[model samples]
Target chain A: MRNIIVTGGSRGLGLGIAERLATDGFQVIAIARSQTEVFDAAAQRVKAAGRGALQFHAADLADIEAIPALVKAIRKEFGALYGLVNNAGLGTGGLLSGMNDAAMAQLLRLNIHSPIALTKYVTRTMMTQKGGRIVNISSIVASNGFNALSVYSATKAALVGFTKSLARELGPLEITVNAVAPGFVDTELTSGLGEAGYDKIVRRSALRRMAEVEDVGSAVAFLFSDGARNITGTVVTVDAGNTA
Target chain B: MTSRMADNTEPSVRSTILDEIHRIAALHNKQLAPLTDALPLMESGLDSLCVAVLVASLDDALELDPFAEDENLAFPVTLGDFIQLYENAAA
Candidate 1:
């Protein structure tokens, strides 16, 4: 079976992507800080598909020094890897003047730096195998300048830029690289927005509603499928036409 | 960059890439380190922005894209492999 790794897989969009791939016939390695109910729900999805298995590894993706060793362990256990979803990220909000260097540093490290480092190692192995896929979970905030999200937007924008170029570099190997930019989904990350804030976002969207987690997960699953062979270096936004 | 390939082209290209590498490393605030063929490019302390710039510069200068055709290429891990990639493309 093909092996795939999903960072931030315990909850949010990462769990959705992991479960979707599992049901679609790929073994998934879920990495997150801790196990969650969503992770167990992912297992049920895998079982419903009648094939593939789910494994969880709890790690702080922010602790990037351990990534190489994590990759080695995954290789020893699952053999060859064909997919990687760099979905691990944190959202920070504050006025530019109020934001401290430490907060900016943490946001940059987790959102932008760690994924690229992980991708570097994973891409090397994929090259040896002659093919693979990489999908980065970017945010619509990267494109639209959201209030109080200046630093967060900057980091996400960087990820989008990296995805576009790396796709070109890896195209020769049939290893596609892409990013999925989701707008407001009803995930825990957005819960802090409160009901009024949530409704305001939904009204702004052309579709008049926030997206379900499945919408973004399905997009990720499509990128990994055979039909998406020619798609690369682009962002698939799954925000109910919110960005439109 | 407009110069034609010549006997001196390889060395000039190598040094130019080296200069760009140093520029990028410093831009990212990474500690200056020695550049050697065996030094891992990622671990050389260049971040994604730095690596992306270096790769794009090589593409513009060399103009031989191994990824453009049916050519099969391995991912370059070290400085040597990256330079060798352009060298192989040139050949």
Candidate 2:
């Protein structure tokens, strides 16, 4: 079975992707702080698959210093990781003047630094094996540039750049790096915004509705599939045509 | 200590949890406002890092596993909401 590691697979888009991958017969190892919930969800996904298994690990993605150790642990547990989805991230919004250094640092650590480090760590393994797939969860704000999410957008934009560069570097090794930028996915992260907030977002979107978490999950699954072997370094937008 | 002694001290723990929530809120550049017991944490604009920090701090201050389970404890939007979770866990 092909083994994969999905960071932040406890809930939201990560969980959705994990579920889809599990159903597709991949050995899914989900990494999240809430091990119990993540494992439970993974268990359900594996059961739904009927041909795959799931493993859960508890780790804080914001602990950038621990990323190497995390990859090592995955190596020990899974032997070979076939795919990695950098889905763990946080969205903090404030004017540059309003955010303190610590807040900004925290955002960068989780959203940018950790993903970069994890990608590098995983790429080494993938390169040795000469095969793997990597999907980064970016945001529409990466290109659209929202007002309150300047820092968040920049971090994601950096991921897009990293994806393209890494794709070029790793193309010969048969490793593809791509990003999926979801527009207004309905997940716990955005659930805080009530109906009024949803309406506002929908109004701005060409599709007149926000993308479901599953929408992004399907796109991520496609990138990992054999069909996407020739496609790399591309940012696939699943944002309901908001960026159109 | 007897039941009465513990009962008398309950409010102190509650107060401490409230203070910690406010501290965390301030760290996120949010003002400490009157929060209800059921307000969702994200509604107040506390992002994921703040939630992680709050969980870590609660773990240390209360000396209990606040996230003993993986259930999403709705972000505490109000000081009271934060206190209630601590009180429940500490109890």
Q: Which candidate is the best by TM-score?
A: 1
lDDT of 2 by residue, A1-244 (tens): 9988888887778888887887778888888888666558668757875987777888988887788678878888888789999999887887887888998999998998898988877776665456899999999989997767899899999899999998987786688999999988898778867898789889888888889988998998899888999999999999888788
DockQ of each: 0.04, 0.01
Fnat score for model 2? 0.00
Q: Rounded to one decimal, what is candidate 1's iRMSD?
A: 9.1
Give lDDT tens digits, candidate 1, residues B1-91: 3344477445456766777677656544677557889989878877654566566445445544454333366668998998777766677
Model 2 C-alpha lDDT per residue in residues B1-91, reported as the tens digit of each score: 1022355764356655566667767655866446566666666555554555555555545555454443576545565666766777777
Q: Which stretches of candidate 2 lie over 4 Å from their true place?
A: A36-39, B1-91
Listed for each candidate, the true contacts retained, as a fraction, are 0.00, 0.00
Q: Which ten residues in a row have the lowest lDDT in candidate 1 chain B?
A: B62-71
TM-scores for all candidates?
Answer: 0.73, 0.70
| Residue A194 in candidate 1, Cα distance off native in Å | 1.3
True lDDT of residue A103, candidate 1: 91
lDDT scores in order: 0.82, 0.78
Residue lDDT tens for model 1, A107-218: 9999999999889767766754558999999999989988888999999899999999999888866789999999988988888888898998999999999988899989
